[model samples]
Target: MNRFILSVSFSLALGLASALLPLSSAEAAGPRCLTDCTPRVGIVSAFGAEADILLAETTGRREHRIHGRRFTTGQLRGNRVVIVLSGVSMVNASMVTQQLLDHFRVERLVMSGIAGGIDRADHVGDVTVPDRWAMPMEVYWHAGAGLPSPCGVAGDLACLGLRLAVGEDGRPLPPFVPDGTDVPAGSWHLRQNHVLSRRTAPQGAFFFDYPVDAEMLAVAQGIEPPLQRCGPRATRADGSIDEALCVRQVPRLRVGGRGVSGTAFLANARYRDYLHHVLQARSFEMETAALAHVALANDVPYIAFRSLSDLAGGESFDAEAGALFTSGLAEANEAAVTLSFLEAWRRRPRR
Candidate 1:
């Protein structure tokens, strides 16, 4: 009887141990599930300061839970920041945005990144916080307008008469481009000095090419307080950089270094019009629109923060894309901006 009693006691102890082990493993594995939890904020970017910050931090795949859902399934900035890199085009932006929403369930989102200053008065490196973001209300495009159409064109065409119109109700109506717009036939050269002088063949059927910088705004709505500007391109074709890309100049205007030219256009009339209609932010970037679209659709608040790498209108910072060299201008400034952004979010007044 004693032996039988001891055996029973040992077996019960073993079972308890097994149950505790499984529970421990589960607890150690991933983020805790929280219902009606903390509000989450999102950060997005394409290139420049914000891009650098993301590249510096994230390992690509991560997950965290915030707010009522798991908005930040993968967190890079402690408990708050959920970072995403939206590849350079509108489609990429839109696709990733949806994925972020489904996975993280973000609440407030901020769209940020470097944008070409179309406003001549606006130099480079200046930041813009827009009250509104305009998007294509109509799905229409035109060719032969001497401007680069989204479906066609290589070089940076002028923003002659493209308009991003909204309805009286204040939502996007549709995206339309004036007739006779000359779309880039292929990928053209975009330099660092704010010069957009290349032309290329048409690639995608959807023509999204229209000036999205500062100048377009003045032409379209005549809003005062011209956009701010910043430094020029810093990365080289080989992805390496010399001292030329450094932000030696105050309120750096030209693209970094004497050798590389800036690829993006300055605030041309066309760019401003498109940005005002599509994005309508203080500044423009390659990634913001897509992030905004997704977050807004899901009723999530998103934010984007970027460091200025180049000025709006100037020479190419590097000779080619993906240049091997790094722009000193971009490297130095990005860190501070990123940190500040994080702290600011924590302090920002939440709705």
Candidate 2:
């Protein structure tokens, strides 16, 4: 009887051990659920300084790395946030934005950065929240009449526009004359989605002009001091501030205007005028339009806060003002507006 009782006790102990071993294995394997419980807001910046400012204020932070990019997940002013730097370009911005959306539970996207001032009314340190963003770089090239002459009218044409259409052989192609007989040679046209100024296009194409979320825009509007009057001064190597580059005029926020984005860093007066007059853009940057496009494609709500770092080509031929002074001020103003918007968003009831 004693031997039988001992045998039964040993079997029971073995069964208990088997049950506990599975639990230990499951715990060691990590959580089965990878999804975040809380919805996250995505904040993107193109520059290091801009990311630094936002990340510095975040709390309960955790770092993530995917495809060589670092995404910082944290809470800013009671709101869950995911912040990342979109390297300065349309492709870079679009790729990282898609990654963030796929990896996290991001409900909305916000971009805060500095841009070249396209409108004369806007100045350095002034923040702009545009209703929409346009891309002007995507264009169709029309072949020139022929090889441009070195002087006179041909030279002028080449200098102004024809040079952009020249082939690698250093010769201009024949003008595009579409005829029923045959398609014109050297005539280039982009598919609808790649073109800019979709509003002007005859047919719907994936053209430019991505609108910001109206509700998000309203949130930005409600923030106090949306505009700034003055910009911060630049510090010299000796730690002295450069007064010449300082903007004494108080900067103010301008809401509900058009913003343009392109890969080129524009610093030409003619191009700047074209953006302001033709495109009706108040601000021009490198990343916002790309970000907007990605967000829109994913059906995610989005907004941008852009501060004027310098007049695209208005301040100086070499863009001295932006390089020497306004960048810091623009960065600071953008960060301020972004933080204010996040705080207000946290307080607002969910839709």
Tell me, by lDDT, which candidate is best: 2
The C-alpha local distance difference test score for the whole of candidate 2 amounts to: 0.72
Candidate 1 lDDT over residue span 280-350, tens digit each: 32344455545544444454544343434333333445331112124333433443354445544444445
Worst 10-residue lDDT window for candidate 1 reads 189-198
TM-score of each: 0.47, 0.69
In model 2, which runs have C-alpha deviations exceeding 4 angstroms? 1-37, 144-207, 226-242, 314-327
| Predictions: Cα RMSD each | 15.6, 13.1
lDDT tens readout by residue for model 2, 123-200? 667789999987766544446434334446552343433232232364432233334333454332211233322243
Candidate 1 has an lDDT of: 0.41
